[model samples]
Target: MAINQKSFDQVTGALSSLDRNPQAVRQRVVALEKVLERAFTVPGTQYKVGLDAIVGLVPVVGDWVTGAMSAYLIWEARNLGMSKWQLARMSGNAVFDTAVGMVPFAGDLFDFVFKSNSRNLRIIKAHLDKHHPSTVIIEGEKL
Candidate 1:
């Protein structure tokens, strides 16, 4: 079985779009990418979408948005019936993002790298693979 105990793939779901099937990964990446675009010129860019302009710079609001997004990932995992340990690991990504994202500018920096949406996507992917290795992630499945 390609099943791995670790939720690595689930945590990295944002990139799943780059995979053969792009549904799950593509949606999450696109949405988060929008957030990054509006918030910064570039996520890590010093002059462009740097972490400074990111909403993560805002203490309460930024964290709320980030948390909400993270919860979506967890909700997906629940629908997939992921194991508790897997869900916890997925939550860890969200928790880390919320906690560190609370920082002033530093949180934005964390968001750039941590990428809660991407992390959640990864968790979802991992859960899918672990639970249903034969499954193919098609766009319609999202509907």
Candidate 2:
């Protein structure tokens, strides 16, 4: 099998352990989203930011590094069997974030506001809720 397929199967298999504990999967997703996009709040402002934005301050290399981190969320969504369209949209968000994020000052500012990982996580949650309801965790209870 292709390496990508093999790695995907491994991820799917690993995630299957949480089939009877959907709350765990939900927790994982939520934690990852926070880490990637909402780890902190700006003082005296309603805005929040995370490590993705922090790392993105290193000029050219920073955006690429964070882009790879963002890809992990999409990879997990694929393991959950999200549709191609949803996956494509998620990829686009990351790509857009990364591309514009390479623009120095403006990119750092954009990263603070764009928050692509959080957006992608929301999309993943919506897809799971609507199409894979079995995997959704609702109010500490597995739906």
Candidate 3:
């Protein structure tokens, strides 16, 4: 499938805006949720909850929200037609970032270190490269 850069940018930019929305503002939540799953519970496994559980140790829910947003991006990638392998890789990065990122002060340290969205962006670009060979990949410079 041909991927349009305009559409891709718009979708991601909109998804990134969820953090600022008031609870009552949910027009895009349902639509974006399909592309992004952020639940307190990880389904089918009683033992495994999610970053919220791990990050709850902090004074506020900083790392938890960070991790959920990361998962959301991975979900967005699925909408972008990324392969399962890419999805796994993306999920793993998010998990690692969230898990290590909850350490008292150390976790926040790690969060600053691991940019999951940048990594996921790379994965998406790579997938696009492999699957959409006809499409030209443009850097900051002119193509």
Candidate 4:
């Protein structure tokens, strides 16, 4: 079957660029989630880890680099109206991840499991769902 690749691409592009609205924040969150937590598959295992873990292998410098990238999620969450406590929780996660990530080989393993970006994304999504309900829509129903 010959498919119209251009049309498909256009549709996907539109769907993926939902950053115009407040709830569209999920788009960026999802992007960060992919980069920080779910970018690759480990051979012979069902686990996935992303650039955050890969970069954390570079000793001290790597932890800083990945920590900076992870900060973007907290920034976005703040802009999306996450509360102070929520922000603190998110910050705590990032701090812990970065601090532990400073360890030698164990840091890489920590990064694989302690996905701060994903955790922060969940908190942001929940806050948006509860307080700014209009911002989120799910399964064709308004949240």
* lDDT of each residue in 33-108, candidate 1, tens digit only: 4454334453465644423236567777877775876676676566566789878887887787788878777776
Instruction: Please write out the lDDT profile of model 3 over residues 27-113, one tens digit for every residue.
Output: 232333323323334567543233344444463466677677777667666766667998999899878877776677776555444
List model 2 lDDT by residue over 1-143, tens digit each.
Answer: 45798899999898666543434455677888898888888899987889888989999899998899888788778877788999999999999999999998999999888988888989988977786677776686765
List the lowest-lDDT window of 10 residues for candidate 4. Answer: 15-24
lDDT (10s digit) by residue, model 4, range 1-143:
76699989999899566564565677678778888888999999999989889889999999999899878888877777677999999999999999999999888888888888888878988877787778686785665
Q: Tell me the spans in candidate 2 whose CA falls farther than 4 Å from its real position.
A: 1-23, 134-143
Models ranked on lDDT: 4, 2, 1, 3
Q: Candidate 4, 24: how far from true, in Å? A: 2.6
| Residue ranges of candidate 1 with Cα displaced over 4 Å | 1-53, 137-143
Span of 10 residues, lowest total lDDT, candidate 1: 17-26
Ordered by TM-score, highest first, the candidates read 4, 2, 1, 3
Q: Residue 16 of candidate 2: its Cα lDDT? A: 68
TM-score of each: 0.57, 0.77, 0.53, 0.78
Which pairs clash in the backbone of model 2? none
Of the candidates shown, which would achieve the greatest TM-score relative to the real structure? 4
